[model samples]
Target: MKTIDPINTTNPNGFKNQASAALEDTNLQTALQRAKSGFIEKRKKAIHLVDDFEHLKTQAQQAKQSALDNLNHHLALFEKNVVASGGAVHRAKTPAELNQIVLKICQQQNAKLVTKGKSMVSEETHLNAFLEKHGISTAETDLGEYIIQLAKEKPSHIIAPAVHKTRQQVAELFKHNHELGERDLEEIRALVDEARAMLRKAFLLADVGITGANLLVADTGSVAIVTNEGNGDLTATLPKTHIVTASIEKVVANMEDAGKILQVLGRSATGQAMSTYTSFFNGPRRTEDLDGPSAFHVVILDNGRSDILNSKYKDMMRCIKCGACLNHCPVYGAVGGHAYGDVYPGPMGSVLTPLMKGIEQATPLPNASTFCGRCEEVCPMSIPLPELLRQLRNDQATKGLAPKLQSMALGIYGWLARKPRLFQLTMGMFGRVVKLFKVSHILPQETPAPDAPDTFVQQWKKSKQGHSENE
Candidate 1:
């Protein structure tokens, strides 16, 4: 089997070009349209079934916030418990460190074949590529992840990694890759079965398995994994060694707090009351255990998250990776995730990519929002995404990353606002010019100038005059 090469998928700098290309891709547009409404409606229906979704959101938010407030204590407790349960804990300050640590473990195990469940952190570190470059064979067990892996592409959506792929595209990919020899590939079930059959062999023969954690229970030292498919469980148990890659923010104070977050996580993510498989692995299997990985390792990654904890964007740490914001974001709907050009995409990604990578490297990501407030409205964690995006834009201006023309225009507008009469006079002249020359084309395409007879200032003056006469 051919392995994924080390590819540079983090291209936030090329957002404009990628977004333009995404807009023109007919197949991508079809896939986006098909998945968009289903995700939105499902979340709405699920949330409505609850008596008070707001209360649930509050509880989850509080749980996450409390954990973050005492993050050090919780992480230490988690590590201690893991060690107590016969599991080892490894801390990585950077992505390179994470890859190196995982590589060291793989080398120690003399692993040839490795299987993986869906891990966004691994994607962030590009773990598969790194392992493959070191001559380790990796197989993605998650159906969505497997599809993208076959295509040699990065995940487009957080939960739905292959959301950008159409059914036809997937069939073609399978046909090219799999030697099933003219088996029926038209139906979704057939495709799923094909993937399952292929991965089952990898499951039994795999030397190592890797998965991501939804929440790390600090009290029990448990890694909670939620998945609709049973693949995560299989991936974790089938191999002798199981590795978990997670960020430090994933650690909650206790199982109860983790439960609180899980209540809303399913509703906000996939509209399930509980996912099909919500498994908690405390440690490796004991001697009496029937079936489980013998060796368990938890790799806790910092990767700038510790800095974020102390920063103004600390509110962002509460994100559950639910992708509710992505489903509702109009900007995301229009351009799709590939346009963001990073491991993460959409509202959360826009704010996070800039912060995780440098603001300078991901300058365009922060500016990718419509700021319609839907993302924050639907957020289970109430992350204040628009506010964060605005702050990033402010940072861009502060760092001189914004365009000179845009900065000068905003400066002139700010100066004019200080003198109301002068501002009104300047605006009146500009409005007339815009109307006379039909220069609305110069404005943003999404928000063209309204064809009103008079400006708001002119209308306000007329209303004031009428009130004075009546008095």
Candidate 2:
């Protein structure tokens, strides 16, 4: 296996600092504000239009459950079907193995330039960086992905890779990278056209193309890619060789199962009934085919997912990569994806990251949530995100991965929670100090903190004194 360069998996105890910095970044704030309500409102409108939206969600969940229940069986059947279709399936137990498999395919083809579609699994494994380090130039075809590629950043959102970027920021990135002279790319159409023109050249010249799967069908050995831009079609078709990098959990029983999930995936991710391009590539181009890749390969990675399947975090594997959970999450809307300090972020990432990288490295992620339950509420696949996060926190506590200071604070809080009288007294004193801070203008005067109400003990005592006086 080829040794891939180490990417930043997670920052140790860095979520708070990263979140504070994100809160302060003017550009990020502008982009986030623009996007915060759009996804929420659009999804609301889209889901409302469908009379059976909840039914679709239920069907999707059932399909996912069925797939997971027979994961190994479906994977085996998928591999068999792929081989029967004249395509190859590579099972990688780790990221290193996946990278090596992809690299070996490229090297065998003597690939000099690789054109890529939006593959979050590739991002998860740091595939672009790995390929570039080994001397292969890569081009990102998706407009959002292309922008982020130039910016040298991982995707902030699964569907909208460059959602953190504003039109102005995109204009700057284009002006810096492309040779277009003094063009007004302030408009989205202009920026998109410029990227499309640039990517078209790379698409024709590249030897290999790589994409991620929305779902893999076991019955036909097809890799289904759902995209709005149609760039994924070009990326998969133009190159001589096509490579798909997906996790093992993406496999489904058949095309029917794929359709069941697809119904919910589009509405949940981008508020579309159907994406512009939902292409399925089963194998290499047939002799009668006009166009397609000469070779097709599917690289399925485990990368701690196998461990998750057996553990309490198994529900996470049902995620369809719909950005709905992130869009609906208040914490994600405020701080954006980068603050979580990993490739994945928001509610799903909080649970997935700690499991993938271990609780020690990703201790802050599970604690990043407010337990608002919006993620689970909006998830089309019905994944229980809050429950899974609580599981990670419990695992962390069990392993003693939490900081001593935090442990001490929690210990004190636990003690206070147990003693009713002492807790009431402490709360009364704390409320007075808060009121004092407000009165003296010690805290921010712009936003007044709500003074704590009288404790239960005090209220009870006052009622008793009033009764005694009446008697």
Candidate 3:
């Protein structure tokens, strides 16, 4: 209902500033505690259940790479399949064009109340804002999304929109916005009950239901989506018109390919044996179906991806949105999602936001990594996240977008280190300078007291002298 800009909402110390502040907020601590453990533990158990899960990961990653390497080929195959399956396909080369195409559908259908089921593509386009600007009322049916919608904030994490919210906040929000007096289970259930009731009405009366796809099959022209809450199922089935928005690369070759994707997606993302509901819509519903939307539209969005093809950074397109990369990232663990200041966050967000918006707008994002490879290690799609980040860092440094003082300091250090004599002299002087503080005596052994008698060069000299390392 209200507009949330990523740039204005996120704090800028990257994650440390937000996480330390969050540590003190009892409410946020409670909200994040579950998120931190629950996701990892559940996924661990789920991944262990499958045979060949590791091998499957390798296969999936290779498959995604193949798709990205030859995207135009796959996209054409996808378009042909969808048309054959009776769905209309629209290609939007830009966000503004995507918005116009979606609005045209809503206006044509005389849509007044639109119910949504967690489409990130819609978030990418700021569709709610665009639609509301034209007087169309949109409601988010996913519980986390509904909480965020009520709060008038952007999703902190892609998969878990309100991952940053505490139960008390939800309780307070329900009380303030929907009249959940006293916040009892009767009240909480009443709140849940209330959302179900409200959304139920919107579903019945809505002319259009909009959603984002988890995957698209080029072989059958089908829209594949996974959800725990079943809201996606309702939004698609109950409405007269169903509209799906997704980036251009979501297409896979066939149902078998989609299954391989789902295998890793559930395990890596949430650690579930299977998502509660998985739907494959082959062009709305067939005439044989008793209940289904009469018309189905799939909008392919390419706001900025086409140019990334064959570029060093295009591996980003391999993301499946499982949130595994976010879960495993050290920086993401420390700061949480809000700091990156975008629809996506953590490693995946860092790679995606820069690619979509340009490194110029998000120069700080590349440096957000600690060069931690966990995100890439666990990526089911095996995207070279650290490699991409390294490239972006180089891009920023070359462009003078990196902090001048830090860059200059590194340059000086590099020059000195290249010459051993100058390097040793500089190091010895630096050590003596730190020694002057007398504070070095109190410092932990982990840090070599710059003046520590056994510096790297000292060890190197001793090794050349054939002295024992310990001596």
User: Which candidate number would show the highest lDDT if scored against the true structure?
Assistant: 1
State the TM-score for model 3.
0.91
Compare the candidates by TM-score and give the number of the best one.
1
Per-residue error for 209 in candidate 2, Å, reads: 0.8
For model 1 the local lDDT of residue 57 reads 89
User: What C-alpha lDDT values do all the predictions have?
Assistant: 0.91, 0.88, 0.81
**Model 2 error, position 99 (Å):** 0.7
Error of 2 at 262 (Å): 0.2
Stretches off by above 4 angstroms in model 1 are 1-10, 440-471
Model 3 C-alpha lDDT versus the unseen true structure = 0.81
Local accuracy of candidate 3 as per-residue lDDT tens digits, 402-429: 8899999999999998988888878776
Error (Å) of candidate 1 at residue 471 is 14
Q: How many clashes does each candidate structure show, in the order listed?
A: 0, 0, 2
lDDT score, residue 413, model 1?
99
**Full ranking by lDDT:** 1, 2, 3
Give per-residue lDDT, candidate 3, residue 307.
74
Prediction RMSDs, each to the true structure: 3.8, 4.4, 3.6
